[model samples]
Structure formats: structure tokens, C-alpha cells
Target: MTQDSRPRSPLAMVLLALLAEEPMHAYRMQRLIKTRRKDDVVNVARSNSVYQAIERLLRDGLIEVREKLAADTGPARIVYALTDDGRAALNRWMDAALATPAREFPEFRAVLAVVAITGPDLVADRLAERAEALAATLDVAEREERTSREWGLPRVLLLEHEHLVAVTRAELTWVRGVVDDLRSGALTWDTEEMLASRPPE
Candidate 1:
């Protein structure tokens, strides 16, 4: 088959991986994501999102309906399995994801670019709040990791949680440092001067 040209969204890639394990219905896939904590990386909060990805994969010929089961009380259940192309695509996506970092435009980074407009004092206060939130997230991730280890889950299985904790800790540390600089007047900026320097629309 020709190389798949569809975008490898996180949701789509994850669905493919789950199917790679075994053929399963959409509900099972969604439940597995939540139960396995893959939802932390994949957005399966909405059931419709999973169905939409399935539809796209079907259109691209990446996945096929393996079977449909008759249900006594509801709509028939459709089981999906990965096509050969889907497995190949999944492997390619994993390789690229691991070897290369995609350019991501996070809202926080965008705000930081023009944060001087908000003035250092307000920015410092907001960043302090953000630091607290990050700390709480880190705490949760650390606790989850400990629980997983206690359950005998291997380090490989908890790598993503480790990444989340490390990134959150780093961000919290950086935010606290910036807050200190702002409070000590080390990072002060002139709002009037900044406004005057803006180019014409």
C-alpha cells in the first residue's frame, strides 16, 4: 500500500497502538486509555473524539472493522483492528516522535513573550500561582509513580510520568526564581517605554 499521508495526531497514534495489542471496540479502547492512564498523554475525555479518530483511520485505510457484535440492549458494538499500513504508520510515528521533538506552541510560552506588558509585579504574582499549581501536579505524578512501582510496574512503563515530574519541577524552580527577581526589582521594566516602542499597526 502507498505510504499513509494522514497526520499522526496523539489520539490517532494511541488508538493505533492499542489496536496493535488486540482488536477491541471503541468503548474498550476509551476505557483502556483511562484505566492505563494513557489519557494523560492522549485526549480521550470525549467519547466522540475516539470515534472521530476511528473514522479518520478508516477513511485512510489504516484500520478496519474486525467484526460487529449484536447487543441485546443497545447499538451493535464495532471492533476495530489495525491494518498492515496502520502498524507500519504506528512504527514510523513512534520513531519520529522519539528521535525528533516537534515544535509546539504552548500558551504559557506565548504569554511569556509579551509578559512585560503586564508589568513585572503582576506577572510575578501570576507566575507564583502557576508555580504552586506545577508543584501540586508534580506531587500527584510522584505519588502515582510510587504507587505504580509498589504495584511492580517496571520503570519503562512509568517513564512518561517521570518526564512529567521532571518538567514540572524544572518549571516550578524557574518560576520561583523569576518571582524573586520581580519582587527584588531585578526584573523591572518601564511600561511606558515598552508601549512607545511598539511599531505602527
Candidate 2:
């Protein structure tokens, strides 16, 4: 099938995936995402976002309210289920997310781009500090991976964590080299020279 031209939010996909597994209310879906640590990738931090996502999904015909449950107290809760369109969209999202490299502007990369204003010495020291912290994080990830393996968690399930560890380790190695270059005067440069080298916007 051709990909839908409409935009789909990550939260919407998360909700769709949850609904595909089983019909649930927004609150329950949000809880499952957190309880399962899926929140690490999908941002279900706000209930408002979840509700908003539901509204969008409904409007787009991706999902529908399956039933309304009257609460003992407070308002009634609407249970949602995925439509056939939603299942297709969910599969599309999964395929795109897994196969495509998004053009994401991570904060660290953005900071690194403008960090030259602070001078190489300062940036190098900061990079070294970041590397040390990343090393600690890598140690934790390694331990977690070992424990997960011992617990019989399949490799497919832990691939996301493994990818994170691999990327962080590569970054740490590059940062260490940069620190050495800065300290050894191999990357010395003046602020004015840097400014002059850049074309005016």
C-alpha cells in the first residue's frame, strides 16, 4: 500500500499499537506505556498529549471509541480501539521508524555546532567531562544488558538499548580524540579567524 500523505504523531502511533494489542481507555494506554518503559521512546509524559492524540486519531478515522464505561466517581471513560486504517498506519509507522534515519536535531549536536564560541580549551574540557559521564552510562547499560540477557529477554527486544550503547560508545571514542587534539594544540584556532572563515548568512 502507498504511504499515507497525512502526518502522524508518535503518540498516535503508540496509542494505535496499544489499541492493536487490546482495546483500552486513554488513561490505561498511558499507564501501560510507562509501566512497560515504552515511554523511553514514546513521549507519553502528559495525559493532555494522549487525549489530543486520541482526538486526532479519531478525526483521521484511524481509531474509534469502542465503548463508554461509567465510573463509580468522576466522568465516564471512553475505551478506544483501532480501525483497519489504524492497523495499516501502525505497520507503516513501525516500518518507517525502523528503516529510516530521521533528520533529528539532538541538543548535544546543536550545542557542539556553536560551542566554538567558547574556545577549544573550554569545549575540550566539556567534551572530556561528557565522555566521562557517557562512560558511566555505558557501564550501566552493559550491566542492564547482562541482567536482561540473564532474565531471558530476547535480543530483538533489547536491540534498542544495544543501539544506544553502541552509538554512545562511538561518540565517546570520537570525543576523546577531539579532547586530545585540542590539548595538544593540533586544533588551535582564533575566534576572529573562525568568524572570518564563515560566509555571511
Clashes of each: 0, 0
The C-alpha local distance difference test score for the whole of candidate 1 amounts to: 0.88
In the range 1-201, model 1's lDDT, one tens digit per residue, is 123333369899989999999999999999999998899998877769999999999998989999999999899999999999999889888877786677689999999888868677788889889988988998988898889999998899899899998898899899999999999998899888998999999
Q: Which pairs of residues collide in model 1?
A: none
Candidate 1 deviant stretches above 4 angstroms: 1-7, 199-201
Could you give candidate 2's per-residue lDDT for residues 108-155 as a string of tens digits?
A: 989978876668878888888998999998899888889989999889
Model 1 earns a TM-score of 0.94
The Cα local distance difference test for each model comes to: 0.88, 0.84
Cα RMSD of all models vs. native, in order, equals: 2.4, 2.3
Candidate No. with top lDDT: 1
